[model samples]
Target: MADRLLDAMARSASRLYGGEAVSELEHALQCAELARAAGADEELQLACLLHDVGRYAVDPSLVFDTGEPSRAGPHARGHHEVGAELLAPWVPERVAWCVRAHADAKRYLCATEPDYFARLSAASRHTLRLQGGVMTAVEVARLAVHPWLPDALALRRWDDGAKVVGKATRPLSAWAPLIRRCFDR
Candidate 1:
């Protein structure tokens, strides 16, 4: 399972991340590093590393409406939902929740934090529209009571900060053992 998961991540190593300066793998590594630096547990770190795995794991040919209310889009699942679903059988529920809610975390931040939208990168800004713009008051209320909300928000912070062009990060090899352990768990 770990090997398969790692391979999925490797396939995106050279792929640009939503027009961000960094490649998808780079963003993943950097996000994991940020989690580590913040003293997050292994589960959270792994969640950060594989948060965007859906982009590579799911069929790219699948098309969907980005503005759909269900967050499922029209014909396909959103990447966050896909990633969480893919990880659900391997990792803990908390990890999968973090993966699933990171986008909602972005939406949460945008709605609750004035000036947050302006700080987003251009690519993130564009994706934000596709991610349902901002949370409605009811949506915010729903997310606020989730037990895992704090971890998801932390993962979101790491995701937002992981887009440096040439930032040094631990290689995928360094994380292979950790990935295996998570899968084994």
Candidate 2:
């Protein structure tokens, strides 16, 4: 399973993350680096690494064909949901939850922090509107109580910061042990 996940990521090494400056693999590696630097536990670091796997797991025709997700096509599952479900069988439940909630974490931040929206990159800003924009008060209240909210929010911050064009980060091969541990768990 770890090899499967790593292979999928390896396949994405050349694919740019929509309009982001890095490839999808690069973005994932960078996010994992951020999590590791922040001293996040292995599960949280794993969550950061695979949070966007849904974008790769889904039918390519249905996802990011254009700069934005296609609204006209068959109801495409959100990448977050897809990613979380994909990893749920191998990783801890909290790791899956963090993967699922990272997008909502962005909405939470945008709603709760005024300047947060402005910090988004152009592609992210475009997707934010499609992703439901700021959270409603009710939505905010619900997410606030989720046990994995902090991890999700932390992953979101790393996600946002991982778009550096040429940043050096550990290669995907270095993560095999961590991925294997999660799978073995």
- Over 4 Å off, model 2: 61-73
User: Tens-digit lDDT track for model 1 on 1-185?
Assistant: 88888887887787888777788899999999999999999999989999988776666534232222344444675678878888899898999999999889999999999998899988788778787899999999999999899999999999999999999988999999988887856
Q: Over 4 Å off in model 1, which ranges?
A: 63-74
TM-score of 1: 0.91
The alpha-carbon lDDT assigned to residue 101 of candidate 1 equals 94
Worst 10 residues of 2 by lDDT: 63-72
Give me the displacement of residue 159 in model 1, in angstroms: 0.3
Global local distance difference test of model 2? 0.85
Compared with the true structure, all predictions reach lDDT values of: 0.85, 0.85
CA shift at 123, candidate 1, in angstroms?
1.3
Query: Per-residue lDDT for 20-53 in model 2, tens only?
Result: 8789999999999999999999889999999999
Summed backbone clashes in each candidate are 0, 0
Residue 83, candidate 2: alpha-carbon lDDT: 77
- Can you list the residue pairs that collide in candidate 1? none
